[model samples]
Target: MEKTDNIQKKIIEDVIYNAEKILEAFNNELDGVLDYSVKSLEVIDDDLLSQFHENLHDVDETMKENAIIQFGSYIFEVARRNYGGKYYWYEQLDQPILVTGQPDFEISILAFEKVKQRIENGYEDNIPFFFKGYVQKLATAKKGDKELIC
Candidate 1:
């Protein structure tokens, strides 16, 4: 009985270790893709930006799929580790408008209520242009039927 218990504990530890390694690999891959996307956007002309804007709805729809949820979970874990208990934590419910800064230096999700309040009260002029866009996207997004915001 004692040997069996020890074996079970070892198995659990191994499973957790393997899972952490997998998550690390996923984060590295995601970081590469995001870096490439940002660089590509930076080099694009105004016409291309306009084209991207025209296709924004389609892109938004794609983002709301399972990938976004998984990505949100990843982001939440990262935030929890880095920020600790400084900010309120929530799972990725619907499509969260991600507010990321230069790779992984600083990243966070904007709460739905906060986004709504910004829309009602108006954003301060000092807020960055990209963040304002994120707020707007969150405002217009349709909430997921099953996922809770908080």
Candidate 2:
């Protein structure tokens, strides 16, 4: 039991660390643009990250994966920081889902999966649109009002 707990704790730590690394990466080449704010995510949308993904094709496979992971982490951080949430391992999906809200309502953000789609589909898969919509829905559930979020 202790071993399992230790492993789970370490996994969560690494997941969060991946997100934190984005800030450092931004300073180097990613335009130093991540502020961990929801608005910042909107900036990275459109062809910004899609173009970045296209450029990654010239690099090693690890670099491509890093592009997905780094931005995926950034998206996860934005949702977690703005609305409050906890990451849980979805064993069936084999993904770390950051679930926000509870009892009254619940909104789960599949940060990594959405990032992959944004890279592939370009503007069609809007990350901010996905996140803000879910959060707004959750807030509406709780408050019984439709106030804009993000």
Candidate 3:
């Protein structure tokens, strides 16, 4: 029992640590627009939502989809909270562009893919709540690490 408890505690710590890294990167990318304090974010549960598990036989595929949606939602929610709206517009050169434009959307897609790859290839830690690569990619994309819009 004690061993189980310790493992759970460690997993929680890892989640919090990863969350902090993600938020920091996000804030940096937006130049402090988010201003997300660590105290504002919390991990509520580790259980998968039942809606994503209707087809038990396709558990693997379902889990992948669920993870993708959840991660995407998290990204969208953070943007919304910080930007004070669900979406925003920016001008690139002389063209107006939506924040969730192709490149930005691809970031979320790639994040899901990375998580899926990690799951299939095997991960050292059983904790599936966070993927460091996904978080880094998001941070980079948001920070305009590539040709993406900030």
Candidate 4:
């Protein structure tokens, strides 16, 4: 039993690490766009600033998709590990919870709330294209010993 628990713990750690890496990659990509936006705002005129902001959004659009894919991949991998690999940490869902930097935290909360609201409202068609699969996977996951308050 001890050995089984250890193995399950390891699997959970691996999933959490993979998710964090995905977040790191997403953050790195956003950082570049944000840095450019900041620098541009410092010197550009109001008219150009609006355009810069628009362009920034255009450039960073892929990051949102990447973030969703990362979470989806995380869910898939966790399910794989628990079922296929015999590491049964699925019983303790708290193990793979993620922590983010303050700015990232704010953005994540806002994005999650938006998604949650859409899902609650039955606005299926309006869900963000990127998060659709991720949210679905999350919804289907079995509740475990660990609860995510957020």
Candidate with maximal lDDT: 2
lDDT of each: 0.34, 0.69, 0.36, 0.35
lDDT of 3 at 95: 17
lDDT by residue (45-124, candidate 1, tens digit) is 12222333345456554433322233333333333343331232234533333233323233345433332332223333
Candidate 2 ranges beyond 4 A from true positions: 1-8, 28-32, 46-48, 56-60, 142-150
- Taking the tens digit of each residue's C-alpha lDDT, what string does model 3 give over 1-150? 777567545533443344355445454544554333222222211222222233345658765655543433343344334432212222233211113223443332222333333334433321223333334555555443433322
TM-scores, one per candidate: 0.25, 0.76, 0.28, 0.27
Give per-residue CA lDDT, model 2, range 1-150, as digits (tens): 777577657756867788787676554465656777887887667535757656655757676577777777778778878887666676765667776775445567777777777776666778878877876676666633332222
Poorly placed runs, candidate 1 (over 4 Å): 1-54, 60-63, 86-150
The model with the greatest TM-score is: 2
Clashing residue pair totals per candidate (backbone < 3 A): 0, 0, 0, 0
Q: Candidate 3: which stretches are off by over 4 Å?
A: 1-59, 84-150
* lDDT at 94, model 1: 31
| Candidate 4, 13-122: lDDT as tens digits | 66556545644554454443212222222222222223323444463646544433344334334334332322232234323232122222211112233322332333
